[model samples]
Target chain A: NAGVTQTPKFRILKIGQSMTLQCTQDMNHNYMYWYRQDPGMGLKLIYYSVGAGITDKGEVPNGYNVSRSTTEDFPLRLELAAPSQTSVYFCASRGTGPNTGELFFGEGSRLTVL
Target chain B: AQSVAQPEDQVNVAEGNPLTVKCTYSVSGNPYLFWYVQYPNRGLQFLLKYITGDNLVKGSYGFEAEFNKSQTSFHLKKPSALVSDSALYFCAVRGGGSQGNLIFGKGTKLSVKP
Candidate 1:
C-alpha cells in the first residue's frame, strides 16, 4: 500500500513564482503535516491539518498556505517563492493511538528557487 | 516551548562497531519522543518512539533508543553498525497539548564506514 504519496519529486521555480506541493495518504490518518528541511535545520513545520476542512499554521508558516479538503489529501501552496524557500519539503501523516507521535513521511519534494 | 537537541552534527564509525547518536529534549510536561532516519534524497522514516513504559524501545532495522526521563535524553543506539545504516538521524519531541505536532532536532549525520 502506498502510505503517503507526494507530487513533483523535483522542481525549480523562479523568484516570485508560485506552485503547489501535493500530498495524499492512504493510511486514513486524521493528522497531516507539511515540513521543510534545510541543510542543517532538520525539519520545520509549515502547516498542518487535524482533519478534513480543518487547518492550522505551524511554526514557520510564512510564504506558505495549506488546505485539507479531504482526509486523504493535504496540499501546501507556496506564494511568490523566494530563495529562502528553496528546501526539501516533506508531507507526513499519523494516526491517533497510544503511539501516535510517530509520523509516516512521503518521499519528499526537492524545490529550488532562483 | 518544547524542543529537541542532537548534540553531534556528524558521527563516523567503522562497520560492526557499536553506534550511538545522542539526543536531549526539554518539555514542560510529559514528553513523547521519536527517532527518524533519512536516506539521501529521501523522506524521513520513523525509527522508534518513546511514549511510556520501557525505557528501552526497540525499533526497525535493529535500532533502539533509551529514554532517560531524569536526564531528558532519548539516545538512539545500535549494537553493531552496518555500512547500510549510514544516514541522517533526527530526534523529535511532542509535549502536552502539542496536538501531535513534533519539534525536531537539528539532525545528526551517521556514517558507518566499512
Candidate 2:
C-alpha cells in the first residue's frame, strides 16, 4: 500500500496567493493531521480530522483550512499566503486506537511565499 | 496541556559509538510517547513508541527508546551509530487512551561522523 502520499512537493507563491496541498492515505486510517516545520522548531499542528467530514483547529491553524472529504483524503489550503506561512508542510495519519499509534507521514511539501 | 522537549539542538557522535538523544514530556494523565526521524526534505518516520507494558520499546532500524515514567523521559538510543543514521529526531507525546492529539518537541539534529 502507498501508506501516505502528498502532492506539489515544492511551490513558491506570491504574497496573498492561495494554494492547496493535497494528502492521501491508502491505509484507511481514521486520523489525519497537517503540520508545518520551521528550522530548529518542533512540528506545529495546523489542523486535523478525526474522520471524513470532521475537522478541528490545531495549535497553529490561523492561516490554513482543512477538509476531510473522504477516508482517503485530507487536504490543507492556504488562503492569502504570507511570508510567515513559508515552511515545510507534512501530512500524517494514524489508525483509530486507544493508545496512540505511530504516525505515517508523507514525503512533505516545501512552500515559499515571496 | 501535553508537551514534549528535546533539550539538545544537535548531537555529534563518531561512527560505531553508542548514541543517545534526550527527550522529556509532560501530560496530565498516562503518557503515550513516540520518536520519529526525518532526513533532509523528507517526512518524519516512526522510530519507536512507548504505550504501556514495557518500559523499553524497540522499533525500526535498530533504534530503541527507554520510557522512564519517574523521570518523565523517553530517550532514543542506538547501540552503534552509523553515518546513515544521521538525521533530525523528534519526540512526541499524547495522553493515553482515546486522546488522538499529539504534542511534539523541538527536534534534535543527529550527526554521526566516520
Candidate 3:
C-alpha cells in the first residue's frame, strides 16, 4: 500500500499566490492531518479531517484551508501565500481503533515563498 | 494548551554507546505520546507510542521509550547507537481527544559519531 502520498514534492510561490498541496492515503484511515515543519519550530498542525466531508482547523490553521471530499484525499489549500508559509508540509493518516495512535506520514512537500 | 518539548536541540553520542533523547509534554488527562524520526529532506517516520499499558514502549529501528506519567515525559533510548541512527527525532502528543490533533516538539537532532 502507498500508505500516504503527497504531490508536488517541491514548490516555489510568490507572496499572495495560491496553490493546493495534494495528499492521499490508501490505508483506509479515518483520520487525516496536515502539518508544517519549520526549522527549529518542529511540526505544527494546520488542519485535519476525521472522515470524508468532515474537516477542522488545527493549531496553526490561519492562512490555510482544507477539504476532505473522500476518505482517500485530504488537500491543503494556501489561499494567499506569505513568506511565513514557506516550510515542509506533511500529510498523515491513522486508523480509528483505540490502539492505532501512531501516524503514517507522506514524503512531504517543500514550499518556498518569496 | 497541549504541547511537546525536546529539551536538546542536538545530541551527540559516540558509536556503540547508549543514547537518550529527552521529551516532555503538557496535556490534560492521559496523553497519547509518540516518537517519530525524520532524515534530512525526508518525511517523518513512526518510531513508538505510549497510549496505555506498559510504560516502556519499543518501536522501529531497535528504539525504545519510557513513558513517565509523573514526569510527563517520554525519553527515546537505544542501547547501542550507530552512525545510521543520526537523524531528527520528534516527540508528540494527542491534543484534547480530538480527531488526530497531534502536537509535535521542536525536533532533536541525533548525531552518532564513529
Candidate 4:
C-alpha cells in the first residue's frame, strides 16, 4: 500500500497567494492530520479529521482550512498565505484505536512563501 | 491538557558511543507516549510507542525508549550510536480524549559524528 501520500513535494507561494496541499492515504485509517514543521520546532498541528465529513481545528489552524471528503483524502487549504506559513507540511494518518496506534507520515511538502 | 517535552534542544555523540534523547510528558489520565524521527527533507517516521505494558519499547533502526511512569518520561536511547542515526527526534502524547489527538514537543536534534 502507498500508506500516506502528499502532493506538491515543493512549492513557492507569494504573499496573499493561495494553494492546497493534498493528502491521500491507502491505509484506510480513520484519523488524518496536517502538521507544519519549522526549522528547530518539531511540528504544530494545523488541522485534523476523525473520519469522512468530520473536521476539527488544531493548534495552528489560522489561515488554513481542511475538509474530509473521503476517508482516504484530507486536503489543507491556505486562504491567504504569508511568509510565516513557509514550512514543510506533513500529512499523517492513524487507525481508530483509543490510546493506541502511532501516526504514519508522508514524505512532506516543502513550501516557501516570499 | 496533554503535552510533551523534549528537554534537550540537541544531543551530540560520537560513533559507537551510547546516546540518549530525553523526553517527558504530562496528561490527565494514562499517557500514551510516542517517539518519531525525521531525516533531512523527509517526514517524521514512527520510531516507537508505549501504550500500556512494557516499560521498554523497541522500535525500528535499533532504537528503543524507556517508559517511566513515576517520572512521566519516555526517553529514547541506543546502546551504540551510528552516524546514520543523526536526525530530529520528537516526543508526543496522545490526548486522553476519545478523539485521540496528539500533542508534540519542540523536538530534539541528535547528531552522531564519526
Candidate 5:
C-alpha cells in the first residue's frame, strides 16, 4: 500500500495568508490526525478525524482547521497564518481495531510563515 | 491528562556498543505506548507499539522496547548500535479506556559515533 501521503513537501506563507495541507492514505484507516513539530520539540496534535465527516479538535487546534470529506482524505487548513505557525506538519492514519493504535505517518510538509 | 517524557535531550554512543533511550509516561489507566524514529529532515516512522501482551516488544531495524507498567517507562534499546541508527526518537502514549489523544515526549536525539 502507499500508506500515507502528503502534498507540498515545503511551503512559505506570508502572514495572514491561508493554505491547506493535503493528506491521503490508502490503508483505509478510520482515524486520521494532523500534528505540528516545532524545532527541537515534540509533535503537538492539531486536529483529527475518527471517520469521514467526523472531525475533532486536538491539543493545539487553535490556529488550524480540518475536514475529512472522504474516507481517504483529511486536509488541514491554516487560515490567517502567523509566524508561530512555522513548523513541520505531519499526517498520520491508523486502522480500526481495539489494539490498532499503530500510526502510519506521511513524509511531512514543512511550512514557514513569514 | 496523559503525557510522555524523554529525560535526555541527546544521547551519545559509540558504534557497535549498546544504546538505550529512556522514556516515561503518565496516565490514569492502561496506556498504549509507541516509539517512532525520524531521520534528519524526514518524517517520523513507526518503530513499535505496546498495547497489551508481552512486556518486551521488538520492532523495526533491530530495535526493542521494554514496557514497565509499574515504573511507567518504555525505554528503547538495541544490543549493538549502528551509525545508521543515529536519529531523533520520540515516545508517545494514549490512554486505553477512551480514544484519548496521543501524547508525545520532547524527543531524544541519538548520535552513534564511529
Candidate 6:
C-alpha cells in the first residue's frame, strides 16, 4: 500500500510565487500532518488535520495554509514563497487509535526558493 | 508547551561498538515518546515508541530506548552499531490529547564508522 504520497518530489520557486504541495494517504488514516525540515534543524510542524474538515495550525504555521476536504488528502499551500521556505517538506499520517501513534511518512518534497 | 530535545548534533562510533543517542522531554503529563530514523534523501521511519507498561522499549533495527520518568529522558541505544545505521535520528513527544500531533526535536546525526 502507498502509505503516504507527496507530489513534485522536487521543485524550484521564485520569490513571491505561490504553489501547493499535495499529500495523500491511502491507509485511511484519521490524522494528517505537514512538516518542514531545515538544515541542522529537526522537523517543524506547519499544519495538521484530525479528520476531514477539521484543520489546525501547528508550531510553525506562519506563511502556510492547509486544507483537508477528504480523509485521504491534506495539501499545504504557500501563498508567497520566500528563501526561508526552501527546505524538505514531509507529509505524515496515522490512525486515531491510542495504540496506533506510529506515523507513516512520505519520501519528501524538496523545495528551493531562489 | 510539550517539547523534545536531542542534545547532540552528531554522534560517532565504531561499527562494532555500542551507541547511544540522548533525548529529553518536557511535558505536563504522561508523555508518549517515539524514535524515528531517516536516511539520506528518504523519509523518516518509525523505530519504536514508549507509551506505558515497560521502561525499556525495543524497536526496529535492534534499537532500544529507556524511559526514565525521574530524568524525563528517553535515550535510544544499540548494543552493536553498523555502518548502515548511519542516519539522522529524531525524538518526538505527544502529550495527553485526542489530537495526534507530535513535537519533534532537532534531530541527531548518527555516524557509524567501519
List pairs with backbone clashes in candidate 2: none
The global C-alpha lDDT for each of the candidates, from Candidate 1 onward, is: 0.93, 0.91, 0.93, 0.91, 0.91, 0.93
Candidate 1 per-residue C-alpha lDDT over B44-99 given as tens digits, one digit per residue, 9 for 90 to 100: 99999888899999999999999998899999999999999999999999845645
Error of 5 at A12 (Å): 0.8
DockQ of 1: 0.84
lDDT, residue B70, model 6 = 97
Worst lDDT window (10 residues) for model 2 chain A?
A: A94-103
TM-score of chain B of 6: 0.97
- Candidate 3 per-residue lDDT, tens place, B1-114, comes to 788889999999999999999999998778899999999988999999999999999999999999998898899999999999999999999887667667889999999999
Cα displacement (Å) at residue A19, model 3: 1.0
A-chain TM-score in candidate 4? 0.96
What's the TM-score of each model vs. the native? Answer: 0.98, 0.96, 0.97, 0.96, 0.96, 0.97
Q: After superposition, how far is residue B11 of candidate 2 from its true place, in Å?
A: 0.8
Q: Which ten residues in a row have the lowest lDDT in candidate 3 chain B?
A: B94-103
Instruction: Give the per-residue lDDT of model 6 (tens digit) for B1-114.
Output: 898989999999999999999999999888899999999999999999999999999999999999999999999999999999999999999744667778899999999999
TM-score of chain A of each: 0.98, 0.96, 0.98, 0.96, 0.96, 0.98
DockQ, per model, reads: 0.84, 0.74, 0.87, 0.70, 0.72, 0.82
Interface RMSD of each candidate, angstroms, one decimal: 0.8, 1.4, 0.8, 1.5, 1.5, 0.8
* Backbone clashes in model 3, listed as residue pairs: none
Better of 1 and 6 by DockQ: 1
Per-residue lDDT of model 5, residues A11-91, tens digit only: 999999999999999988888999999967899889888899999888789889999889999999999999999999999
Q: Which order, best to worst by DockQ?
A: 3, 1, 6, 2, 5, 4
Query: What is candidate 3's lDDT per residue for A11-53, written digit by digit as tens?
Result: 9999999999999998899899999998999888899899999
Error of 3 at A114 (Å): 1.5
Residue A83 shift from truth in candidate 5, angstroms: 0.4
Model 2 over residues A1-114: C-alpha lDDT tens digits?
A: 799999999999999999999999999999999989899888888888989999988889998999988999999999999999999999999896666578899999999999
TM-score of 2: 0.96
lDDT of 2 at A54: 92
- Kindly list the per-residue Cα lDDT of model 4 for residues B1-114, writing each as its tens digit: 888889899999999999999999988988888899988888888889999888999999999999999998999999999999999999999876556667889999999999
Residue-level lDDT tens digits of model 5 in B1-114: 788999999999999999999999998778889999999888889899999999999999999999998999999999999999999999999744344457789999999999
Candidate 1, B-chain TM? 0.96
In candidate 3, which residue ranges exceed 4 Å CA deviation?
none
